[model samples]
Target: MIKQDAASRTIEAIHESVRTYLKQGLTNEQIIEKLKEENLEPYYIETVIDNIYKEYEDKKNLKNAILTGSILVIVGLVINMLSYRLSENMNSSAFLLFWGIVVTGIVTIIRGMILYRS
Candidate 1:
């Protein structure tokens, strides 16, 4: 029980140190070096940094995907409306192309939604 308590305290201390270094805007290398000086394991330091970076990347990607998807959907809708309004007779080829754009836009939006949820 004492060992477990000590381990918990140690983990909490490490987390606090990480948060402090991050708030100070230290680079990952600097933070790693500081943690090393504290005798923290290299694996633990690397894992923490990796997780932080991965989460940041995930958020960025999610934002980009959602924005792109929304734009594509809006563009597809505009194109369909323009085609209908501008053309007296819609050709079969153009109809197919319109449906294709709409389908692609829908798929992209769905993919973005999935990424956001994940």
Candidate 2:
């Protein structure tokens, strides 16, 4: 039982290390080497690194999507307000385009928020 407990704790520590190293932008090779130095099995090291990379990619995509969506919404609102104030003789097509931009921006923002929350 003691051996089992020690082993579990060690594994947990390794997982924490993996997370920290990934956040520090360590490459797979470097992570693997560090894990090896800790005497972790090669298979476990590879698996952990792969999982971390997948997680990192997911987080990065979520952040990028959120930023892009926010920018689009802000830009759309600014353009719409400017056009409305500046142009008294705006045509129907221009109006449609302005509204379209606003709608698209709103949709993107909603999508990004959903992704981030999930």
Candidate 3:
């Protein structure tokens, strides 16, 4: 029982390390390099590093999606404001708002899809 407990704890620690590496956007090869510098067992370090790289790729995609969506939303806001002030007719102002909404919605949907896929 004591041995089992110790094994479980060790596994948990390794998993946490992998999670940290993934969050930091480390590639599989990058993680392997880092792990090699540590004093961990060869097999254990390699396995964890491999898994972390796969997971990190997915997470990095999601992060990029979010950034793209945020940029679109900000740009849409600027366009909406500038268009509203420059327009002379109510129709043009409304059209600008519509375009802004469409852009914001498209970006948000893209971001959601990426996050869901990840």
lDDT of 2 at 74: 82
Where in model 2 is the C-alpha error above 4 Å? 1-12, 22-27, 36-39, 88-97, 116-118
- Measured against the true structure, the TM-scores of the candidates, in listed sequence, are 0.65, 0.61, 0.50
Cα distance off (Å), candidate 3, residue 45: 5.5
**TM-score of candidate 3 relative to the true fold:** 0.50
lDDT of 3 by residue, 1-118 (tens): 9999999998887778777877888876676677667767667777776665666776777777677777777777777777787685555535457466547756775876766575
Ranking by TM-score: 1, 2, 3
20-77: candidate 2 lDDT, tens digit per residue:
9888988878888888987788888999777767777777877777777677778888
lDDT of 2 at 34: 86
Give all candidate RMSDs, comma-separated.
Answer: 4.9, 4.9, 6.1
lDDT tens per residue, model 1, 1-118: 9999999998878877887888899988899999999888888998877766676777787777777777777888888877776663654344423666667767777886687677
Clash list (residue pairs), candidate 1: none
Most TM-score-accurate candidate: 1
